[model samples]
Target: MREVAFIKQNKEKWLNFEKAIFNQRFKNPDELATLYIHIVNDLSYAQTYYPKSKVIAYLNQLAARAFQKIYKTRRQETNRFLYFFRTEIPMVVYQYRRYFAYAFILFFAFVAIGAVSAAYDDTFVRLILGDHYVNMTLENIENGDPVAVYKSGSNWGSFVGITINNIYVGIRAFVYGIFGGLGTGWILLHNGIMLGAFQYMFQAEGVLWESVRGIWIHGAMEIFAIVVTGAAGLILGAGILFPATYSRSVSFKMAFKDGVKILISTFPFFVCAGFLEGFVTRYSGAMPNSLSVAIILVTLGIITFYYIFYPYIVNKKMTLHTYDSTL
Candidate 1:
């Protein structure tokens, strides 16, 4: 592509970014990141084909200016974390909805498969769940404490171990997307099946609802994080498979960066899931059913709102703004 064509193609976006930088109303990290990506894309091409061209000089100047303004504003406040939840994370999630859908579908399908298989085969749970887990669960059931599995770990220890392990698994699923997303999907399928079988184990014993109220108090978020991580992997794979308008290398770089960013941003959610599982889930046996039900519903509601509703809201707001940072 000619330098003129490149500039022409992105003239509007560059102009909007320029305006936002000066105006400051929309010059958040999101916009700055978008501008940085655009500038780098242009700079990379220029350096490759026209290293000595005047266009390269212009791009460098614009990029430097954008960076200076971006770093100049430091709004330190007690409510920084509050604002991040209210704004930042939702934007990132919105930008990657396709991957999220893919992960959700993959997990849902596998969960269904597990549930159906366990329904038909009395020994299916034993096969998938291992002898140790099945025996422990049976003992708990006989002792009138069917969900004691969650209570076995100390709060702090379980929190740390579960958080680290889950985050590790999620990241591994994402990293495995390099093998064309098959690796991530396979892991997701395994998890989904385990979850389905685990649930069916309780249902077979006539404690499905009870189990849900106990397990899903934390599993909702934990499972959601896993799906999002899988989405990240698919995002990476898709970028490699479908470069679209960009060159293959450019597409891969952008996709990898975006996928990693989305995964890293879920750190807080993962920790929260672990905390709930290790601390809150342990107390489910004693907590009021009303309270447990409320927690599960509310947690599911929040998940639905953020991953589903909030993305649409953000996309709508962007359309109204005439320039989405996602572009």
Candidate 2:
């Protein structure tokens, strides 16, 4: 490309970046880092292709300014943790909301498929859930305690074990995205099928409502985190498959970073789910119906509000902030 055309092509973007950096208008450190990476790439291109041109000098100056702004010592924000959850993660979520929607749709479709298959074929549930497990659950139901499986261990021991297991699952879901998302899809499909078959077993035994009341106490957060982790995997796959205007390498880097952020955001919710499972789910049968329902609804509401609605709110605020700065 000619130097003149190159300058003309990127001139507006460079100016906007300059304004963002100088005015401290970035939403978070990740956003700044992303912009800096792009600017550095542009600088490298300019140096190689137009080394003697004034554009190279201009880009060098801009890149230097961005480096200083990003890396130079500055006063630390007092509420860095608060800002990350309140602003950073939500913004990233909003940016890739489509991935979340896709993951949800794919997972639920598998769930429906599982449900339909189990309904038609009596043996399907046993096949998916394993014969031993189905037989054990049948025995538990006969003993008048369908969910007694939850009370098998000490509360604190259960909490620690469940939390570690859930975190490991979340990481696996995210890491498996490197296989171009197919691995992640398989994971979702397997889990969805298990869930559908498991629930159907309870329904077959005429205790569907009882099972729901006990299981959803922790399943709300636990299942939601799994879905979000699936989204992270899809994002990683999309980065490789659809590079858009950026080079494949750059796209993958950005996607990996963004996906990791989304995955990390689910850690707290996983911990919450584990805590509920260990401390609350075991006693779900003893609790009043109203209390169990309340716990399930509250957990679902909090996760829904944070992952779904909160992103829109934060993105709107960011858009308005950017518009005001332009004016």
**Leading candidate by TM-score:** 2
Instruction: Give me candidate 1's TM-score against the actual structure.
Output: 0.74
Each prediction's RMSD to truth = 9.0, 8.6
lDDT, candidate 2, 231-281, per-residue tens: 999999888887654578867887898899889999999999999999999
Candidate 1 Cα outliers beyond 4 Å, as residue runs = 1-88, 323-327
Q: After superposing candidate 2, which stretches have Cα over 4 Å from the reference?
A: 1-77
lDDT of each: 0.78, 0.83
Ten contiguous residues with the weakest lDDT in model 2: 68-77
Give TM per candidate.
Answer: 0.74, 0.79
Number of clashes found in candidate 2: 0
In the range 185-300, model 1's lDDT, one tens digit per residue, is: 89898999999999988988988887888999998888988888899999899889976545788678867976887788667778988999988998898999999999888877
